[model samples]
Every structure is written in structure tokens, then in C-alpha cells.
Target: MRKWVFLCLLFLPFLSLAAEREIRIGLIDTFDQDFYLETFVPTIEHIQKTLKDYKITVIELQQHNLLANVVKERPDFLVSSAGNFVTLISKLGAQQIATVSRNHAYSPKEAVSSVFIVRNDRKDLQKITDLKGRVLSATEPHDFDGMLVGMGEIAARGFDPDTFFSKTLFSHYQYPDVATYVKVGAADVGILGTCQYEKLLTTGQIQPGEFRVLEAKNNTEACIRSTERYPDTVFYALDTAPIDEVKAVSLSLLSMPKGEFDFEWVPASGFLKVYDLMKSLKLGPYEHLRETTVKDFILSHQKELLLAALLLCAILVHVVRVNWLVNRRTEELKFALAVQRATERKARENRQKLDLLEKSRVISQMSSIFAHEVKQPITNLIYYASALSLLLQQLGVKDDRVEYALKQMNSQAKRTSDIVEHVRSYAKHKANRSEVFNLVEVIRRAINSINKEEIEGVQTTANLPQEAIAVGDSFEIELAVLNVLKNALKAAKNSLNPQTSVSVTAQKHMWKITITDNGPKISEEIFSALGRPTSTSKKDGLGVGLSIVLSIIENNGGHLTFRRIEPNGIAVDLFVKKKEE
Candidate 1:
């Protein structure tokens, strides 16, 4: 037993050593090893600092033959363009650790893009399809953003990118060279990447509006791109890479600051957009989708297709049954709707008849009230007229009595006329037409209409603004205010020290007429029945005042409310819509 335990302990060190993964990073060759290394020096230094114990080695691989070398070497980390990363991910289950950010561009997830350019003088090529049979000048064909991305855009628009252009011209990785070719009329259209045209304009090699963009994407304001953006260069982790080591590298890259490259390292974004583009152009991971045979697809999807066929049959049966049920229900609902509409029509006619009967009752009641009320005024006017006639017969005896008699007769005549007009309007139950009237003036008229002796003998105060414009029927508002003031005066008459105050205030969207008095607290029954017809606290009350006030105010987008004052008082708030300043 001791011997076996010793052997097991001795192999533990070897097992730990075998578990450790190699920290090797593969960098796709861009310009040269030195240039690429310098560009990503900050990232390299950061990784070295983070994984101090591990020996990190970066290998530069040629872009054209990276796939073979990548599979053979099985690199733990691969820093390459999004297209290469996507290919590696598809082939070897590679996962991107971080995306490279760029200066003066969209986020790292949506930075790489390509554009189609033409000289401003090329009026013949107004659109992208115009360059279909024309010569296309572009940078290196192997370059992802400069050439391949533009080709993907063409494919996405349903064009065969392989045969879209009659002839192709290469500018050999110089983005500006393609623009130069277009400017010199060597090619009908040129393709560029990474705002090369805008850079040239900044260098004064191209003027504003000197080149036109074809099928330009408004995806960004930083550059004019013809194609949708994919993610920026990514730091990727292979399937064989150790999870702990990959996490360390990711942390180091993300924490690194922008150095000479003027770009930052950020967490990798989803590459579904890149995958979709590659699928459309038959590139990268989706290359096999284009190569699959029809027979292979049928064999692989036979079960799904069979299930789909069964589902379709079941769906057809369900649809037929549902259609029959819906038709029958629709007919039954139609009959019910017809019966309901007929019932509604009968109810509406009955309502009209009720309204007519109510109006007739109002007319008869108002006629009787008018006749009873106008008799006193008419009798007084006759007496005053007889007195005036007597005074006129006695000539030269000019006294104040003659003038008094004439004024009394005129006053009683006016009263009689007002009563007649009011009863007619009340019996008809016709609403007054609304208009913009000064509320200050309406309140003044209401206060003046009361008996002068009663108002002066009591402690009544009127505080109103100089101008308060309201929107409502002026006559209705005046009547409402007058009736309320009359009630307040009557209630305060018997008080030891009667106090009544009428004030008009202008609110944001409403004109408020507040009538308050030191009278008895309103009864709950009277308060509840407020604004309702045939409800009154006074023995001789007609109950028309508050109802008319509420109805008119409500109809004109206003409100009426009553609040009980502390101790022993009642406050009335009449709100009407104030004209906007």
C-alpha cells in the first residue's frame, strides 16, 4: 500500500504540468510582422503583464493560407480580422474574446465597412447597378474590408458578385489608389474602406463632392459605407484553448489602454450580422451551405419534412372546422346584433318622448310662475302711471314726486319685460350660446343687481380683478352669480355681525367665482342634492338656480362645487373656462 501511494504522489506533478496549456497567439499578417506587432504592442505588453508565469509567443501567419496553418498549429489565441475569426469559429469552434475599437468610427462591433466610389463626373453611373457591366477598381482582393466586404454587399442585393463587373482592376491594398483610379477615369467605379475617401479629402487629394458614393449606407456619420458593418478585428480563443488562460488574456486585453494605435480593446460583440453576410456571399462558415447537394439536404431533413407534412394536414382540418364554427357563430351574432339594435332604437325613441313630456311640464309650470310673479310689477307700474298722470295735471308744481313716479314706472316696466323673457327662455329650456365675455364685468353686474340698502348695511366686500375673460354664455354666468349672491345675502341677513364676500380669481385654465358668507353650515342633505333639480333648502326656493348653474357650467366645460367652511359657513366655487392669455 505504501509503495502504490508513493507512485501516485510522484505522478501528481506530471499531471499538473500536462494540465497547463501553451499561451501561443496567432496574428494574421497585415503589412509585416514588425508593423502588426507595433500596432498591437500595448495589447501584447498587457497580456505579458497579466500572465507573468506563462511564456507568450505571437506568430504572424499569411492571410491567404491561415486556415491550414491555424488547424495544424491549433493556436490558443488568434488575433485577426472578423472574417478570419468567423471562419475559424465555424471550422474549429473558435470563440472571440475581445473586439478591437477604432478611432472616429462606430463601436467595435460595427466598425469594419466598405464603400463604392465613383468620380463626380461619372453622371452615367448614378446607381450601383449602373456599374454592373463596367470595370471595378478596388484594393487587394484578399483584403476583407477593402474588397471582400463590398462584394458581400453586391451579393446581399441579389447580384452575382463573381460576374457582376465585366473587368476588375486592383490597386494592391492602397485604399486611396482605388479612388485615384476613379478620379483619373481609369475605372468606372472604385471600392474603398475605412473612410479612405474622406482621408484623401482631408489631405487635399480630393475635393468635396468630387466623388459620389453608390448605394451608400446611412449607418454612420463617420464614413460613407456601401456595405453593412461587421465587427472589428477580434482576439479569438480556439476550442482547444484552456478556459482559465483565455479568461486571463481577455481581462488583460480589455484592461489595456489606447497607446500608439489610438484604439481600445472591448468585449466581443455578436457576429450574427457577419455570419449573415458571409452566408449571403457563400464565404466563411456558410461556404458549405452553398456546396451542399439537394439530396444531402433531403436526407438530413427528412424527419422534419415528414413532421411538417403531418402538421400541415392537421392544420388544414383545424382550419376547416374553425371556419364552419366561425360561420355559424357569425350568423347567430348577426341575429343577436339585429335584435339588440332594434331594442336600442325603441329605447332611444322612448327617451325622446320622455324629454318632450318633461319640456311640456316645464312650460306649464313656468307659465304659472310667470303669471303669478309679473302681476305685482304690472300692478305697481299702473299705480305709478296713474300718479304720474295726476302730477302732470297739476302744472307748475314741479316736485321730486313727479320724477320718482316716472322712474318707478320705468323700473316696474323693465322688471315685467325681464320676467316675461326669462319665463319664455326657462319654459323652452334652450341653452344660451357661449361667447368670450369679461367675467369681471359679469360679477359687477351681479353685485349691482342686489338691493343697495341690504348690501351696504351688511359687512359685504367685493374683491375682483380689473379684467378676467372667460368662455361661456355671459347671460347664464351672470344669472348664476346673481342667484348665488342673493342666497348669500339672505342667509347672512339675520347674523349678529353678518359678513359676506364675493371674489373673482383667474386660475391657469379656469375662472373661479368664490362666494362665501358667515352663515349657517349647509345641511348634508342640501349639500348632496346640490346641482340637482328640485332640490332646495329654502321654503320659497324654486331649486332652479344651482341646477342651471351646474348644467350650464358643465356643458361649457366648467364645474360647480360647494365646500363647508369651518365653524359655521358655506363656500360656493363656480369654475368656468378662462380664455387663454
Candidate 2:
């Protein structure tokens, strides 16, 4: 009974601790439990003191069992480096609450870096390139600052450390082992965490002159580092953690006093730099991701890729050449078109000038002809009037001869007026006054205009329709008929036993008039030029009558044609449209 009571009393404290509500935090055993205990125990004690209802427990986890431990234990919170937290946060639903900020010797921000070191007496390992075929040592393959950052720095300098160095020595947890390896000549170069390098210096384990940092970057914090910096550590909560407890622990950590741990909790910084390093080296959480080796892929498809490249180059060259040719041809065509337009414009201007000159010449010639034609009639009128005055004085206005002379004077005066009117009508280039009228009446009117003396020797016969109506300029058509009749009369007078006939016929939508004369057949050359101005067969002809008649017929949309009659006569056909279709 006494031994049982003693064992029960001894187990009381442990049982009480287990019974209390506790918040568990998981940490990776990066160094050792003692190191973490020394580093974080005070912060845990501070949190426990603040939260009286909850106790704090720290669980150290190995790397290989970290994901399993987190899933099985489901700790309330976790403590890890930024690189490890990145992997856990992605895979295990961990949320970062705060990042551990330290007053690092090499960085003013909460960051860590890697330093590459070589023995001072080794002159051959002066630069990173000198490490080719040399032995390299580091803490661990996945150590963010010790190995990954160091290799990333070498890669940034265009060197692949994996193939550049002959061998790589992994020291696992002891970063100091990397330094020792270099000092013992096991490695030509060493990569170590900047923190560890500084710690070794402070403890006098390695003198300042024994090893030198390679590619040391100068910073205001005066840290001896060769690689870019990354965030130091992070505190996060798992997805299954109690929300209230996570908040309380985060608040306590943020407000904790600066203790022996020398760490301050601040808002979490971006961990993308660590993520980028992992992705570059394919380490840690990124180890399972596959990557293509560019050298191998290029070598395997060299012929196909080369052919594709050559075809692409050829196509590009052809496109460029075709574009140049098209532009050149377009410019040439534009120039030719411009020249053609200019030439056409010049020809139009020349034609207008020629038309104006022709009009002026026609006006001058018609004026001269008009004056000559009227002069003879005026002189005859004056002579007859003088003769009438003498007879009236001698016979006291009673003689028939005096009356006859007065009539002759009146006739001569009328002839002069008609000549002047005819010349005036030709001078004015007026549009025809059109109306509906009978075609037979128009022909009779045209025949009445001809002088009886001119056709006295020719026998004239008219074959007409009683009611042939047409739509046109009646006066213009009358003049055209008169011109045709006068030509036929002249031709008939020249023939033996001269005879002339006028015939009219109506057909679909048109009136056809034929005037025939037993006259000489016209020569083809003269017939071709029959309607041209200044072309005539008669010696004293003004040569404009047929042309004027042709113009009148054309303006009324009618046609005039002359053909030789059978054996020895001429036939003139005039066609005009009926008013009603």
C-alpha cells in the first residue's frame, strides 16, 4: 500500500499536465531539439503565461515524417523555415500567421543567405569557375541557405554546380561539418549558412584568415554573404487547428518581449523567393515535378527542328520579297494612270479650242455669202423702182407697163427679205421647236418653198398619205425636206426627159419618205462627203445646204440616206419616228 501511494503521487504532475487543455506546436528538427528549446522556450512560456487556460507543448519532427506527423498529430501551430513552410502550406493546408524576424548580421530584414568559402592558402580556387571538377561540401541537399541558395548563386553566374563540381558532400544537420571538410582538404570549396559562418567566427572555431568568402556582396548590414537572401522562418497554423487558439497564440507571439531567442514576430513576408529557389533546383516540395532537359530534347529532334527553322526562314524571305514587288508594281501603275489622265485632259482642252475656231470660221463665211446673195436682189429692186417712176411721170399712172414695173419692184423687195431670213436662220444655232403635226402637210409646205423656175423642166409627182402624224421639230423637218427636194430637182433637170417623184410610207413606229430623180449616179467619193460642210458638186454652190439639212435631221433623231436608183437615177430616203409608238 505504501509503494502504490508513492507511485501514484509521483504520476500526479504528469497526469495533471495531460488533463489540461494544451496547444501543440510542431517544428522541424533542423538542428536539434535542444537548439529549438533554447531558441523558442521563452516565447512558449510567455504565451502560456498570457493564456492561463491553455498550456504549450513543442513537438520536434524529422524531415521524412513531417507531413505524416502533421496529418496525424494535427498540431495547433507549426514553426518552420520559409522554404519548408512553403511545401507544408501547399500540401497540408497550413496557414502562415507570422514570420520570424531576426536581427541578422548579414541582412537588416528578416532574411538568411549562403556563403561559399575556400581555404585562404588555396590559390587555385579563387573564383566560382575554379570549382570545376572540384569537391564541394554543404549542409544538406535541401538546406535553403546552405545548399540551394549557394547553387542558385552559381547558376546565376551561368554555371551549373551539379555538373561543374566533381563531387558534392552533404553534411546533413551539421553545417560546421562543411567548414571542417574544407579545412581538412576534403572539399575544394564549402557552402555554409551565413548564420553558421558568423557563429563559427564568433566562437573562434575558425579564424578570420583561414577561409575567405567567395563573391561577397557588400550590404549596409555588413554580412559576409555570397547568395541572395530569403526570409528566415515562419509560424503557421494547420487547417484543423482551433481558430480561437490560433488567434490567441499569434497575438501572444506578436506581443512577446525580446527574450534570449533574439526573434521578433512580425507580419508574414512574401515567401516567393524561397519558392523560386526550390523550383529552380527542383528540391523540397518541388522534387516530384518533372522538368525537360533542353540539351537532350534538342539533340533528339535536331533534324526536324532544323528543317522547320529553315522552312520558316524561307517563308519569311519570300513574304518580304513579294511585298516589295507588289509595292513596286503598284507605284508603277499609279504613275502610268496619272500620265493617262493628264493626256486625256489635254486632248479635251484641244478639242474645245478646235470647235470654237470652227464655229468662228463658219460664221464669217455665212456672213459673206449672205451679203452677196442680198446685194443682187437689192440692186434689181432699185432698178425696177426707177423704171416705174419714169413710166409714172411719162404716162400719168395710166399705163399697164408702169403697173407691171411696180409689181416687179415689190417682188424683188420680197426676194431680198427671204434671202436675209434664210441667212439669219443658219447663223443662229438654235434648238429645234418640236410638235406633233402631219407629215404630208410638212412635205407640201417644203415643195411650195422651191421656186417654180428651178423645177420648171422637171416633172414632179407626189404620192402621200392623207393623215400621217409624227412627233418632231416640224419646222426643222420641213427645211430638211426642202433641201432634199431642191437636190432632186437639180438632178432631174440635168437628165434627159427629167422626172422626179415623192413617195411616203408608214411602218412600225416610223415614217419613210423617198424622193427619186432620173439623174446621173453619184460617185462614191462624192457620196461619202455629200453631207459634209464645204463639200458640193455644183460650181456656184455654197456647199452648206446638205450639211445643215443633215444636222437638222440628226438633231430630230431621224436618218437621211441616198442611194443610186436602178441604172440611172438617185433615191433619197428620210426616216422619222411616229409620235405614238
Candidate 3:
């Protein structure tokens, strides 16, 4: 009887020490009531079963109220998703110790991904790069695990999540709203969490295969994640919490059973994954988030913090001033280098112009000599051919030879005319002169100058407007027109024997004049040569006519083109931009 009484007295204090102290677990209401009833209850039951030694009570509250109650209830532990965990830890001085990885028939983690959901029919969305500059719908920007991790994956591939997306919206009130925004096409791409997408599919809010992932980045860890797997729901230690208790909880989470739906607890680095992501993606705290209003700055920084910030700003200004001087000197050097480059460019251009002028002068002098020398011979040939034609007519020759002789005489006269025209074109002056003149009237005059005899064997037509006008040297324009007309006549004479025609058409548009011609087809090789200073015809050619034409046209801000007229002919087009009107 004495031994039993002594044992009972010794165990009395121990029994009082074992009496249950309250251990409240705060759960953020990230899910709706249905999910809380179905998923949360079972999960809480398991937690309670595992922590049987303490009087554990799980209190579910909305994220808005989680912080308030943390001060009121002072929970011994907190449980939330990776995103809510960040806010709770930051605001309530609570910590996250474990994260649940769900793997079930409803969601196969092995095939899970952060889906960049777009319309299945959009071919432009073949790659992630195509999503740049497109509007996106997502969760809140602060929801690191939900939107930011996926956004970081996009940024890693060279797209600026903030800028590449033309607009960003947080339409999801919580996890369930993602499917509605995507299904309605409110955005080009809707970013959603893996489990959230499953939930959406299960609820019939979204259809499978209706959306295709634009750019999928896979993460290992049994889930075919579309984004890098962030260290989820990291556990943080309260400043006042016993370090031993925190360590004990962390060890328990790590030592949990290895299974597909297992939860893992690792040491809480307080959203280090998010911090790293922000740094890599150049977003959030890692980026310089500009405070647009003074109120915004004040709300972000308290009075003491603001004072520290002001001192920091002063130091930053000093550093910035020093950097500014360095940059200014560097820019001055750059400007000097740019000026030197400009001088070199000007020198090169001037040299090229001088060389072109020298060549033009040499060609001009040679052409004058050739024209003067050839004029007498051409005149003699014309006279002799005319004399022969008259003799053949007087003989009344029925022979084919007589007819052939007359034909030869006509050809010789045409050759003489061509040479005279070339000489005249080259001899025309090309001086810088600006004057407003009717472009239509100038073209009509040039077409009229096309001799009737040249068009005798072929039909010729002209189409031109009556009121089109331009500002430039009229003399140069006239010379260029004549050269083009002469070339057209020559081309028409080649393939078609007496029935071929050349058509001249002019069109006017705002600040433009277009003259098109139809003649015998010319190859690109020959056409390219036509405007070259040294280019020429195959027979009896000096090559200066078209050269002079190009020179004059270019000086007046015009371009010349000789292209094939489809199957069998050529068209010479002259496009001039009117200087004034």
C-alpha cells in the first residue's frame, strides 16, 4: 500500500504536464466550399491522425481573413498552396513546412504541364514566340506558383512577360475562374495551373483538346509541367517559434511515405524559388517596380523605412551623377566617331560623283566627235539610197531584186535617222533647273514628235492625261521622253513586219507619273544594260542615248524600267515622283 501511494504521487505532476495545449492549424481558403468539403476534410483528418499527441484544430478562412486571424488566433502552424503561403508567411509571421503533390485518376501528375492555352485552330500559335505581343489572361501577378512560374518559363525563352504580352488581366477570382476566361477567348492565351486545369475539365468548364499549348516547358518530378517546378509551399520559421519544433516538423514532412500523392516538407527558405524566378524573369522584387504615385510609395514604405529610403535615394543620386558623367564622356567620344564616319562617307560620295562626272565628260567629248564625223557619211548614204530607189522605180523593174533594193534604201535612211537621234539626245544639256510644268502636256508633245514615217509600218497609239503636272527641268524631261520613244520604235520594228504596234500610256497618282510602253520583248540581261552609261545596241550603237536618258531622269527623281511584256514583248516604264505637284 505504501509503494502504490508513492508511485501515484510521483505520476501526478507528469499527468498535468501531458494535459493538451491548443495547437491551431490555419488553412487559407484557396478553394471553394465543395473542394474544402471533399479534399480539405480528408487531408486534415490525415494531419490530425499523424499529429495525435496534440489537441489540433484546423480553421479554414479566406485569404483576406488569414492575416487578421493569425494575430488573433496565433496559430501554431499554417497550411496553404505555394502562392497563399507566401502572403501568409510575409503578413502573419507564420511558416510553411510541407507541400501536397496530388496524383490521382482525376489528375495524372506524370502528364501535367503549365498550359499556355490557346485556340486549337490558331496556326500562328505554333510556337511560344508567337505569343509575344498577344493579350493574356492569368491569375494575380503576385500569385507566384500560379502565373509567375509559367511566366518565368516564357521569359527564359526571350519573351518579356510584361511587354511581350500586350495586355495582362487577372480574371480568375480564384482557381475556378481560369477556364471561363479561356473558354470565352477573352485572351489569346490563358495561363493556368496544372491542377487548376484538371479541375476545370472535371467541372465541364473547359473541354479537352480544345486548347493547345503554345510553348510548353516541361518540369521533372513525375509531372510533365509546362513550367519549371518551383519549390512549392516552403516552410518559414516564426521569429518567436521554437527552432526545435520547426526542425521537428520539417523532418517529419521529409520522412513521409514515398508515393504518387505524397507531401514533402523541406526547410522553409521563404519563397526563395519565387525570388530566384523573379530574378531570372526580371520581374517582381528583382525588378525595379516603379511606384507611380506618392501614395503607392508610402503604402509600400513606412515612415522609418521611407526615411531610410530617402537617404538611400540621395546616395543613388550621387552614384547616378557619377555614372552620367561617364556616359556623357562616352557619348561625346561616340559623337566624334560618328562625325568622323560622316566625313569619310561624304568624301567617298564626293569622289564617286567626281569620277562619274569625269567619265561623262570623256564620253560626251567622244560622242560629239563621233556624231560630227558620222553625220557626213550618213547624209551621203541617205542621198545614195534615195538615188538608187528612184533608179529602180524609173526602170519599172518587175524583178524581186528591184523591190529588195528599194527596201534596203528605206532601211538605210532609218539607220541614218537613228544615229542623228542618238547624237541629239546625248548633246542635250542636263543642268539643275526646277520649274513646274504639266507632265501630261510634256508627254503628249514627245509622242507627237514620234515621226509618222517611223510608225508607217506599224500602228502606234498614245494614252495620256490632260492635267498631270510636275516640278523639274522641262528640257531634261523632253530629252528622256524622246530617247524612250525612239527605243520603242526600234524595238517594234524587229519581230513584227508592218503590222506591229507600239503603245504609250501615262498614269498619274499622288506625287507620281507613270509612262508605260509596249515594244518587242527584251531579255533582263539586255534590259539591265540599257540604262548603263556604257550600254549600247548590237548594230551601229554608241550606247550614250539611254545613258543620257537615265542621267536626266534620275536628276529629276525618276526611275526607268525595261521589263518583258509577258510572253512575247517588252515594256519600258518610266516612274517619276513629282517634286511639288
- Reference-based TM-score of each model: 0.45, 0.45, 0.39
Clashes of each: 0, 1, 7
TM-score of 1: 0.45
| lDDT, candidate 3, 1-581, per-residue tens | 99999999999897876653445666665543444555455555555666566566766655555456667766566665555554445455655565544443122112223667777767777877778888788875555555776778787887766677888878546643555566666787877765666666678877887777655554334333466555443334454555655665566555655433344333433356555566666543344553358777678779878799899999999999999999999999999999999999999979867876777788878767777888878778878877877787788756788668767777866656665655655565534566888777777777776788776666566555556667776756776877777766666677554223333344453233333334556666776666665545558776667777777777777777666654356565666556452
Whole-model lDDT values for every prediction: 0.78, 0.78, 0.62
lDDT of each residue in 417-477, candidate 2, tens digit only: 6545545554665455678999999999889878989889889999998979998978778
What value does the lDDT take at residue 377 in candidate 3? Answer: 81
Ranking by lDDT: 1, 2, 3
Residue pairs with backbone atoms closer than 3 Å in model 3 (clashes):
96-235, 96-236, 113-226, 114-226, 133-164, 235-268, 521-569
Per-residue error for 36 in candidate 2, Å, reads 1.9
Candidate 1 lDDT by residue in tens digits, 52-157: 8777888867777678988777678888778778888767888878888878667788887888888776778887778789988987765677787888888877
Worst 10 residues of 1 by lDDT: 30-39
